[model samples]
Target: MEHRRLGDSGLAVSEIAYGNWLTHADGAACVAAALDAGVTTFHTAAAWAEGAAEEALGAALAGARRDDLVLCTGVFWPEGAGPNAAGLSRKHLRASLHGSLRRLGTDHVDVYQLLRFDYRTPLDETFLALSDLVRQGKVLYVGTAEWTADQLAQASAAARRFDVPLIANQPHYSMLWRVAEAQVMPVCAREGIGQFASVALAQGVLTGKYRPGHVPPGSRAAAGGEARRSVWPLLMPDLLDRVGLLRGVADDAGLTMAQLALAWALQHDTVASVITGASTPAQVVENAKASGISLDLDVLTRIDQLLGSFVQTDPRLTWSPPATG
Candidate 1:
């Protein structure tokens, strides 16, 4: 596994990070496979599986060397019914960091991120809280997910003022979904913010498992989960047809469709890591191989030709604070 510095930070992360967003149930096996495959970065979130994901990961990494790994988790999603149980307020931030630490069975996370920007919270309060966590030795660095470019600028300024280690950004990026390419990528590059590319496989759409006219058995969409449901609209027949066209490109390179897609995401200079998840040890091994593959200009042009006009590159698709009831 190739390691890269996360933005301008001193911390080094594997190019391919093992994530457990949807496969929290296969935590131990998947984590072991990743570690065996030379993967040193592991990402999870407190909101995943209502915290079961962290527990499972903690158990899986119990015997690993703490200083040698980059373990990341995040806040900003509800952990309970209380009004203050979520968001980026100081109270919630403090509480969430502690909770994440307890679940991960670690003193501190390598990078503690805000899962989403909270428009309702004051930037001062949020930065101050994050700084405090650094001072308290609960979090080494702070990051954001799905934050707009303007928000990143403000946060970057606040982090500097507060001396908080704001080192990375997590956003959805894939061949099929280019929402982060427009504004977010440029701002992050300018700010020296490393990007942890999420949904790099476009919710498995880039895996080429979903046929144009038939839903494969035991696939993510066929499994019928909330994550799959959220991205179902992108699984149209036309989209699949375009995806099939890319298979020829992958075949020419002697790579699987998944590896080709992952390599494309890693091709971006601003991308520090491409986050991938798997439900089995075999899948974990397969995904890790993408880190070794690199795409050239000709292959990229071929991909663009095959997927022309079908890619979703709208920057307006960025996430926002959920409306209160």
Candidate 2:
């Protein structure tokens, strides 16, 4: 697998990293499959499946060299109902990191990220906490996720002010989602922060699996719980149409829709890694193939048109870009 630098931190990660939150303990096969398929990088969040995901990933990667791959995880979510259970406050950050390390079975995570912007907690507090982790060697690098330009600027400034390193930021960016282009991407570029783009497949919408009135049996839409049309409205007519268009482009390229979607996201220079969610070993194998393909600009242009006036925030985080500057 080809690797890209995570900003200026000198850490290189595979273009398409494996994600294991959705799979449980019984799904170690999926974990093994990812590592076998050259997915050296693994991306997960502290709150995913209440840490089960990290536990499973940790057990699966036990024998691998810790430094050979980049392990990224994030903080700032309700891990418990207590007041300190969530947010980027110093207390929660520390507790979360400790819990995460224990779950991941590692003393430290290579890249420790503030998963989201906390309106309540001051950015300084978050930066200080992350810096302390870095200084203490419980974390190698610090990054942000889903933060606005103003929030990111404040964090970066605080990092510099406190003499700490903030190396990366994870955002949603794909052929279907481009709002980061106008805001977050530039911030990272100016600050030399690497971007780990998530939702690159728009929660399987870009996989070309969901169509008008037709949802695959085991697909996310068909899961039919909180994840069905109620959560993401996969039945949206426009989304379905875009899927049809993308499927055609994938066919012409002789690539699966999922592969084309992931490849297109990886084509961006600013994107250090594209995080993928897999429920099956086959899915992991298929997603790994995306790491090796590069999409042509002409095809991307056609994709832009089908996506219509882009959306910055979709229900499932599959944002679209605007039509004009």
Candidate 3:
């Protein structure tokens, strides 16, 4: 897999990062496949399965040399009933990192991300706390996820003031979702923050497995619960029909629909990596092929023409949940 520098930092990560958000049932096999495929980055979060995901990823990587991997995790979701169980306060950040380290069996995460903007916590407290983590050698770099442009500016300023190594932002960027391109990307580009794009396949929608009016058995949409809910909006008949047309584009380019989708997202220079999820080893190997494959300009134009009106580009659509009371 090709590796690129994360933002302006000297650290380089794989073009495709294996993320175990909702698909960690066969973590060991998938992780092994990713490693075999040359993927050096693995992303997980404390909120994913209430920290079980980290434990699974940690166990899966037990034999690999730690220095050879770029391990990333996120915080800011409530891990307990207490009011302080979440957010970016010093106490919570410290507690969360310690818990994450324990579960992940790691001394320090290569990148520790703030899963969301903490509305209640002062930015000063949050940045200061993060800076301390870096100083203590528990975190190598810091990042944010799903934060708005204004929030990114604020955080960038605070990061500078505290001398924090704020180098990346994890955003939900995909073929169907272009919200970040409107505002977040510009701000991050100026601030020297690269994007680790999540859901590059739109939760498997862009894989072209879901037909115009049919939800295949054993599909994420058919499984129900959170997976279904996450993909339901993109399952509209018109969108699915339009997505079906991309098969020709993929065929013409000698790429799978998934590969075309991933290549589209990686076209941007500001995107450091595309965080992909896999339930099986084959999927990991397939995604790794998209790393160095560059889509032609004509193919990009064709995609825009096909999904023009359906694309979600409203900057206001980028949002974060309010702090819990």
TM-score of each: 0.97, 0.91, 0.98
lDDT tens digits, residue span 5-114, model 3: 99989999999999998645677999999999999999999878888999999999999999999999999988888889988889999999999999999999999999
The best-first sequence of candidates by lDDT reads 3, 1, 2
> Any idea what lDDT model 1 has?
0.88
| lDDT by residue for model 2 (1-325), tens | 7788888778888888887656554468876887788878888878888888788788888888887877888887688878678888899889989998998889889888887778777778878877788899998888888777777788889999876779888887777667677777778889989888888888788887777878788777777665575326546877788678777888998889999989888877789889987877898888888886877878988877777774444423422221110
For residues 1-325, write the lDDT of model 1, one tens digit per residue. Answer: 8888999888899999999875455669889999999899999988788888888888899989998899999988888888888888999888888888999999999999888888788999999988888998888988999998888999999999999989899999999788888899899888889999999888888888888777777677776668668668878889889998888999999899999999999999999999999988988898899986779899999998889888889888887776121
Q: Which 10 successive residues of model 3 have the least lDDT summed?
A: 19-28
Worst 10 residues of 1 by lDDT: 316-325
> Cα RMSD (Å) between model 2 and the true structure?
4.7
Candidate 2: Cα lDDT at 47: 85
Candidate 1: residue 210 Cα off by (Å): 0.6
